[model samples]
Target: MLVVGAVVLAALMLPGVWHLLRHGLTIVHEAAHAGVAVLVGRRLSGIRVHSDTSGLTVSRGRARGPGMVATVAAGYPGPALLGAAAAWLLSRGYALGVLWLLLLVVVLVLLQIRNWYGLWAVLVSGVALVAVTLWAPAQVQTVVAAGLTWFFLLGAPRAVVEMQVQRRRVRRRGGRDESDAGLLAGLTHVPAIVWVGAFLAVCGVLLAAGGAWLLAAWPVTGITYPPWADVPTCDPMCPSAASATAPGLPFSVCDSEAVSTPPEIEPHSGRNESLSLRRALALLDVCARETDPTGLTAAEIGRRLGVHKSTVLRLAAPLLESELLRRDTTSGRFRLGPGALRLGHAYLSTLDVESVAAPSLDELARTTGCLTVLTVPDGLQSRIAGHRPAPGTAGRAVPRLPSVVPLHCTAPGKAILSVAGTALLERAVAGGLRPVTPRSITDPGELRAEVLRTRRRGFAVDDREFDPDVRAVAAPVLDHTGDVVAALAVVGPAARMSAAAVQEHARSVVLAARTVTRRLGGAGLGPSAAAGGAAEDLRARRGA
Candidate 1:
């Protein structure tokens, strides 16, 4: 198995065999140029991917502006940078996020693919990713991600070599130079060789950094072993605070003098340093969750985070001064402020999931005469990222739903939860299911069974479980890494969303989910036959 894996990895790295994979890198390369152009306020005209592993991203902006320079510089380093980013996300357990990001990039690029071949290439690749994301197991997703990272890291430098050859050819032919390196050289008054060197430097650094990160992320146990087998190692000799300090000491050791011990082996100090950083990050997360109309006070924040009010105050002080959080003078309550809004906007602006799914959502809402909603997973819960109302529904009564919904009750919530592993599900329901209605599944075992049923059926149903009158059916949206990033649901009143209506709407909802998944670059539909079973499921449910 190891030898086979080595062979596969080596094949993916070799340029001769690697051309089979170069299309993806080419798309990323062109997308990087377009992304940078748009980020700098340039108008992206279109993108063209050629059969020769080259692509062009055309943008309109100031002729001699920084945007042009950045766009020119982006092409050669794009794939390497993207691969490094994927490695970084994987290292931090953001594999699904990376997949969704890549899928978004591809979908964005597809909108501008100027040729039939380019469209075909992108569509096929996207479909493949969707299939893997929706059907493949988590381990397969990891391998697919790692393979992509390796291909990009190893393939980028070779492309630089090709650029150098192209430069020489252009010189011999006295042809108008067109390669990205040549264009960059012309723009910067730098030699083509120098541009090539810069490309090499960037690709080389990414290769080394990404490789090291992937190695570190690799488990000590064999790949076949479950992730639980790879236990986190901790320092056995690290002394507890109670054991390290004298038994009769009255004063707390949290003071500055606590570090008066020998510097050579202050394990307690090292732990404190680590804890300080972790506590700050945890405090930020706790505060970010305070989107409630009534902001949380220090006392409430401390209680929720399992810390003392003094500790919460101390931790919040830096955030308050940084303006990442706001405090109400009258009530001493804290909420996310302008700085957090800026951060949220920055992230949302880059995430193309909402943009890609909007059209499908509109169509689904129109076709079903039901409410269409997109929900993205946020920690243990799911948040309504986008909402679409049915056509010609103005002035009609609509069901009100919370922006944040627990993973146990709603259709969209359960759809996302179904894709999460048992460990994550357990963690999500640890506080127990909050009943939104009398029919809500509060028992952990029952909820687990329901999630499993959702997995089997490829859709989740909330038949007045979340709200007494609201009914919904949701399908999980998978990204390129086979992780469920979001859910798409069609919701309506229980009277209209009868068993037959659910069966009918369920098809459209699942299809919309699949469309979003494909747009994001997930592809394997044949193996699962998710849609093929839709009719059969509807028949069964209607009979019941």
Candidate 2:
């Protein structure tokens, strides 16, 4: 009688228990976003929390561009990837395994909490669970069982659909390819539906198993059974001796907790300490090659390191302070900092800089039928880094010479200066904006305004501002962090390059800039820009 009563109680509380489990998954998801945001130097926005859902807070002020797009795309992939990881961890039974599993689930839930609709689903489910746990009557156990069964049937399918929709949206927005869309999507693409079908079938089995376990453990009556007597047996009727086996044993047993048990004496704790340190170093190596760290979070780092977020923070503290990594004040994004810059410079010094850019510049020249020049920012001015002569224009053509020029007076120079902000512009002015030509912009204030406008438009044009009859349009080449690091320009005769002609070629110039950017591993324009350009390119290519 007591065993039957216990089963009824367990059955009644199943829904609430499931909701509780989901809450932890939510936390892990949000933490992943917040961690990545912090790593990229984005501002920490407040977190939003409900019983079963949570969202990591972030805001980008001032700093807007490809970096922002990367950060937004980072959130969706965080959960599903982490969930798989946690599932693996649970299977292995690492230290504090159950807690880790819970954390992973929370992360999963938080990752799903994108809009109000998702938030509502989580909140309502959480409330239902809490209500059942605290105040549900004995007879209500039947209702709880039915509710949990229904939820497993309906909710899991809904989640799968929602995940697909979210992944498609991310791809449309130009995020990293669907490779990171998680296991489900990957399974969906298989020729045989077996993969997806197997996954769903497994989920169904787990749900059924869990439901049966609860139902047999908690009945409508209030009687109770000993914990040992509730353990599940694989063979129900093998023998009378086997009949001693418990019915709800799995409910009380946590796979993660059992697997993660520490050694009795904490053997070789000091030796193991070095393992985390080595792991940290390895992680830094991976991060070094990454052009943009805006989408990285502490939790994401944890996932990469096979450790916890707290551990990642502890390990990264020194790197952060030394400016090997920088935190973006506006968006709270992290990126390689001054130390990394110095290291990159030291490495680059060993190579011939122009050699790296020559082929790309030549390609630009051929495509645009205009002299192409690549320029690097020098103090107060820019030096031509590489140049290629226009196609089809022979020896009789006016010679285009490379010279150090005031940043405000030339297209490539202005394009680079536009991204450097006011302080750099002021320094350039202090050095003196010598009038290179009659059309030269000599006033520092006017030049500053123009640069601001150019930055807003993501490119710059010089209509014989550097030298009369020399008309050009240029776009800035950004580094991994989206800072303008170099410039690319197409220069030609002003008379031949009318204003309308220049405007028409702007798209070409920008496209070339994007190509160079991708080659250099930098993020390109936002989704809207890419989508619009893709449509235009499709039309152009089809016509051609």
Candidate 3:
């Protein structure tokens, strides 16, 4: 088995086969960067595993810091660390566990893929793992698992050596392009050769240790009396953290760390009950985190949950029956069904409108150089539920919010008046369209005409109506039922909001309102058809 494994590893490392096989290592390398980036408080944007066997992980955080250093440094050592882990698991008779664990890792990495080739490469790798773990016979699984353990243990150091040679060539050619080692060198203010040596040293140590474990696991022929055969193995449902941490195992029945960690339960409920609950929730959490509408296959779930498809069937049966999960007839994948929508609605229902619109208000205020407000209808009037002054505005000088403004004069008021339908318009007519300034519409027929114009575009523009020197643009924020919940508006001095600028601010105000709508699980007046008659309105404003 050892000789066969080495032969296959050597064959794969050849110039021809290595080109393709290297992609798996590249996936691990990039995934390592992403995993560490999350751990270090960076927001990961995406990862791309290229066809050239190169990879990139993009994350946002401080450009220079230990976190950045750690993220960059993780790539080269990742495969070796994973191999060491696999070898450790195998030595304990957890060959099946190793395969499942690798499958889980692959599935997690698959979620971060950013390109078509990255998607294709990861999907192929994940499929191969799925086939081997589920379809292969037991003996085939054991041998294949052992083979992979050896490959990762052997391949990692060789990759580092190759990187050094490639880096040297780049230096010789006077190229400024840097490898991970070069990046590390610059990060630490150390020489590039030192970082290269550090990478080599760590990989070599892990390789040696992993190799010893793999060698020891090989069965001896004609050795029925062998002392090692008598040793017992503990496949971990390691009930205590002490035993789990005693020697090599990294996980335990004792605990999990995320929202996936089992919740506290009654003492009488029993461990199996808690374990079962944790498994179900973890499954849902995985599906929910992925935004793809296509959902995940049963094979993908099995890989993700580290359970057999049979176990997925068992757990998912109740969820499907309850309508929390649904099986797609066309794709044979599982997706969160209508019942999950209740849970989402419940969550969104608890969110305060002011809290939801606050960020958008702040952002709009800065970006538009104006006051931004969230306005909601109260009786026949509009109230400012939230507002933020422009960046340079005096904090104490601006009026406090949650304040009232007329329903027919201001932009936000008109926006709400337009979407609140004809009933609200009639109510406004009964209450009277009191002019706030000379430019405010007071004529009932003209007020009706203005409402029609606001409905035509997705936004309403106030032309020195609320206050003679000020102008505003606003858009209605709608709930899922198409009810106007609020309006998002930007207010500025008339000089800054010229007819040309009103066109731009109109789109921005509409976009900001749509953003709040999305966050609240609400819908908006479809796309703003604000280009043609809108231009005529702008020209009319220019003439006025």
Candidate 4:
């Protein structure tokens, strides 16, 4: 029983594995904020769980006070508290109760999720709980419960340690580190490091207490046999061999106490034959990359995995049965199956355009030292949702206005228009092709031609169209289905943004948009769409 928890605790140290696992902790973190906010009489605005495992809980109330402080401080301690509850339930021989509690927790969080990503995360977690509760064998349920308890109890302190590490790194770079500890420091006049130490101490105490409870709840005492493990074989020479081999034998008896002459389980023991989750994912990854119609053979897969071909097929059996991988009967080759597409669709459904585009938008602003913005089509017009200026030009270039501009004149608008369907295009042209500058395309026919050019180039150029002395270049942000969802643009003074400059900047904007597109689970602009633009003439700009 402890082995399961110990394995989960050890897995947390692996970076790749930690990425997916940390989201559960983040959910708990944000739930604590939401719960405390409600208890303090604050109106919970909503919660957003980002793709990167960060979360936000907003509540309407006084910005500062004991209530606000409590809400802010609740996040870091939430998982530990939950783990303690799970430990208590486990100690009482109520393992299934812990699983039910998890389901309840997810349902509550799902009710408050404001963004698609949060909703998807909560829903996925809820589905897993439901599956385990309704379908998993009793043994699997107990192991899962113990593992989850370990994850929460141990993951809390680990998160705090990482938070402190990120804080220090940000401070080293002269950036403001508004971590929970730092926020607490500001509110309570306590040093951030002191708050960090306090969080670590509390979590450590909880971990110690929870661990003891779990240990005491083992099968020898209050617990029973896992009820699913295969019957163990005992030494025939042993006097107590028959009783030791019996079902419902305590773990102590089977593990070491009663079985004095147990057989050894070596690294290659048949009893230890199992495919780990990480290895399964690795197999799927390599198979997914096989573009050939028949896919890679088992021998090739084994070569890539650095294992024997027979071992490959043995390990792949579960994957084939689960429908996550499809094997060709005739050629004995393998490829990703429909089940993988379902997983991909699930991931794509969780993506948010703004959150996905934010990093590239910020990087573009920093790289070009110009005004970079993300725009989406609002009816026939283009709306500027957000903007960032170059490093030294924070308040310059563009006002912090969430303003809409004419689709025919602005770079972002034209970029979006380039790929828009006939209905949207006709509606946009019906808006009179309004001119914002002397050089703007006002005639509907001329505007249609310009959009065609933008389509071929994979980017749009304003060229003093939006403003008399301003030039901008933009590219469309597409989704997994190749539909434009938004546009990315960079604007600068016409003097510094000559035709050559526009060409250079256009490539950067196009590549940035494509990067954001892929990150958002988009298929990206195909070779034909990016041929002359992103491929041949890479856009780049340096703000002056």
- Cα error, candidate 2, residue 218 (Å): 84
For candidate 4, the per-residue lDDT at 236 reads 24
Task: Supply every candidate's count of residue pairs whose N, Cα or C atoms clash at under 3 angstroms.
Answer: 11, 46, 0, 4
Looking at model 4, which ten-residue stretch has the lowest summed lDDT? 535-544
State the weakest 10-residue window (summed lDDT) of model 3: 220-229
Which candidate leads the pack in lDDT? 4
- lDDT string for model 2 (215-290, tens) is 3222211111111221221211112322232231112111111111122322346676655556556446546544
Give all TM-scores, in the order shown. Answer: 0.41, 0.35, 0.41, 0.42
Give me the runs in candidate 1 sitting further than 4 Å from their true place: 1-9, 12-16, 220-544
Task: Quote the lDDT for 201 in model 3.
Answer: 88
Please, what are the lDDT tens digits per residue for candidate 4 over residues 1-544? 5776779877998998898999999999999999999999999989999999999998999889999999999999899989998998886556778999998989999989999988998899999999997787555677788889999999999999999999989999999968999898989998999989988998898898888888755531122222222223333223364445323322212211221112242334453433344346557766865668889998997766555788668768889988899998899899998888898889877888888898998999887878898998898888887777767854454454448888888889888877765456667766577777777888766666566556654667776777877778898888877788999999888767643455456657866887787687664554344343322222211110
- Scored against the true structure, residue 283 in model 4 reaches a CA lDDT of 73
Ranking by TM-score: 4, 1, 3, 2
- Cα RMSD for candidate 4? 28.9
- lDDT values of the candidates? 0.71, 0.53, 0.73, 0.75
Weakest ten-residue segment in model 2 by summed lDDT: 252-261
Q: After superposition, how far is residue 118 of candidate 1 from its true place, in Å?
A: 0.7
| Candidate 3 lDDT tens digits, 310-382 | 8777778888888888899898889998888898889877887788889899888888878888888888888
